[model samples]
Target: MSGLNAPISCDLLVRADAVVTQDAERRVLDDAAVAVRDGVVVEVGGRSGMEARYDPGQRLDLSGKMLLPGLVNAHTHLPMTLLRGFADDLPLMEWLEKHIWPVEFQLTEELLAVGARLGCAELIRTGCTAFLNGYLREYVTGQVVADCGLRAVLGEGFFSFPSPMFPSAEDCWKTVRDLDARFADNPRLRTAITPHAAFTVSPDHLAASFELAVELGVPWQIHLAESPSETAMCLEKYGKRPVELLHDSDLLGGRTTLHHCVDVTPDEIAILAETGTNVVHNPASNFKLCSGVAPVQAMLDAGVTVGLGTDGASSNNQLNMFRDMGLAALAGKVRADDASAMNAQAVLDMATLGSAKCLGWPELGRIEAGFPADIIALDLGSPNLMPVFNHVSHAVYAATGMEVCMTMVAGQVLYLYGNFRTMDIQSLKTEAGEAAKWVLAAAGK
Candidate 1:
């Protein structure tokens, strides 16, 4: 306390039993406090040091809670919340071509908005403060995320064939441009160009989408090697693998985030590393769809930046990052036949800091001075999290998303003590149910 400054004023002071700063050093401080001002963390130190330095307008005493940076969901399809459990237990191609695509052809803007609302609510309750969303009608999704006080990169899906959202590929481009312009200046919402997949999109369309992404200076996302059938199709049609096709089209680079590289080869993994392209692993979704496990440990060994994702509620059946972390660790070990693979601390890093790097947000995913105050509190009093001997082990192996009692983004509490300050969760649930019913009926499902 000798080095502490004279008492200063700030917006909020959050004190907890332990502050798990997921920084480069991975330091976990005991009896810690963080002072936030203007949505930025001004200080993080011992409780006595912070209390001596700043006089806060509001103080939250989380005596029985553990503080950590909010989880970053690197990839998801938010509007698919309406389709959760609508179709399951099928191969990837059959699931998409027969059921998912047909229902998506019946989605209206209002229905899409309802689904986005539901997804936002679920993500907030589960300690996710930011996400990368790839789906249709992204403007609606962007608005919903903005209103819900969450940070997101919203992407509009593009395909060569006509769909319910757009009549032509040009129509999809127009929507992307419109969404980009609308959210260009927004602090909480950003835009991205998303082509459904390499196999589904024509070469010309993919080239145009990448050019547009470059022009807009935003990241581009695409599904790559999600299933064996997809890899087979790419090989049969293009005389190359999916990654080779993207590289040939000049689409593989630092600004690209490829989701589900479950079938990628060693050479492709090296290419991904050399080109600085990011990979997102959706373990639960892949396992559920029988798509085979992604070589996450191999990717990490190849120096590829890998992050964790839930894919979508439809495939994952939950928007919980805690479950994703656990599954990622377990799957990595099983896939590698080594208990040392994807240790608990590494999985936790993938959920927070690693995902932030994938999103190109340097100031997020850490609790430290000058970083954005994106934080969450987990109830340590929970029975499962009791007798915590190791912070990282407890967080990754034992604690579930239900233990997250409060979620804050940019120093603002969005959900606290089971109450949402920004959105109406009950109304969203009712509306989402209605929307799901309408879409199912429209598609005659």
Candidate 2:
């Protein structure tokens, strides 16, 4: 027995049927338990072994559930949750320029906060404990996420031209600086410098933004080669593709997280792998917008770190990572014309460890010793998850987000058995409804 002489003290102990540790070996321990102390995972092993090792202040028994690392949403516009289904059946450019931008013009900080709270609740209920969000009003969104007891890499969206949020490029920079300062010491939140996209952000502004990102030591995020037209526009205007433009601007590196990348070529894929740049593939959003399927299989084959993402609620219409995992696997097989392409395990990893890499959060993904106690439990007793021949396969192919019964971040239980512990879900829904109505009316939609 561990601590045979003196008993060890821990904050919490979680016992489950199986602990799916996505570690180097990807071990799934039956009758496993995890010991957490001060928000860190102290031990993960057999239940009996952990029980012998430590005496925990609180105990949670999930006997029929499987414990896994909390799902990580690599990319999203969380405030767009209020705009879900606002505009649909439109192309990317048309959707943004014609429908989305007009509605965003009427957005307020309060609306953003309301939407963020709803998004956080949805994410927690669905087992997502962390996300990388790129959107406007990030100051409000970041605070709301922190208050909701989740982890996030919140990025303030910037554009070369004036928008409702920022009257000028300088104003945008000021907000970025302020956000960086505010979240410098925050444990649950980090700031990123997010340029809207290559086509929308001027070259000068892009360069400056990247410089600022490097200075702040934060990840640089941008939508690159999301569509054929965007790539063509870059080639015509700058005599380079979006990837090449980033490379020339000194923005292609380990700290860059490029969203979509549906229109990239083989050469660009090589560049991405060479630079160790991360990619977030939003299969559902691409399909909804009629954007081409991303070259995920090829990118993976080339050794590029690609993660799955739900782009935004307005485009994806949902914040569920389970749906994204299923779609990613199905889309990769269809795109590659091979049954072996993008296996279930790979898709699950994308939603967890791979997505954590995109956010530069090395300690947030895996359920291992020394890692954060950010984890979720799935109801293996659910009908769809019955006959659990393979937990990982079921997680990616059959299970939906609704199967998530409990979600915990850093030893803090944020959701349990359809109940939220941090935020009031009913109040958030009411606020989101009012905000949506106000925005739609202001936009004359």
Model 1 per-residue lDDT tens digits across residues 1-445: 3345558889999999999999779999999999999999999999998887788999989999999899999989998999998888988888888988888877888988888888999999999999988998788999998888999988889788888777777788788888988988878888878999988889898888889989988888898999888989999998988999998888888889999999998999999999999998999999999999998999999989888889999899898999999999999999989999999888988898878777767567889999999999999999999998988898899988999999999999999999999998778768977886786797686
Predicted model with the maximum TM-score? 2
RMSD of each: 1.8, 1.3
Query: Candidate 2's residue-wise lDDT over 59-168, tens digit each?
Result: 99999999989999999999888889888999888889888888887788888888888889889988999999999878899899878899999899988888888877
Clashing pairs in model 1, backbone N/Cα/C closer than 3 A: none
TM-score of each: 0.97, 0.98
Q: Give the C-alpha lDDT of model 1.
A: 0.89
Residue pair clashes in candidate 2:
none
State candidate 1's TM-score.
0.97
* Model 1 misplaced regions, further than 4 Å: 1-5
Candidate 2 global lDDT: 0.90
319: Cα error in model 1, Å: 0.9
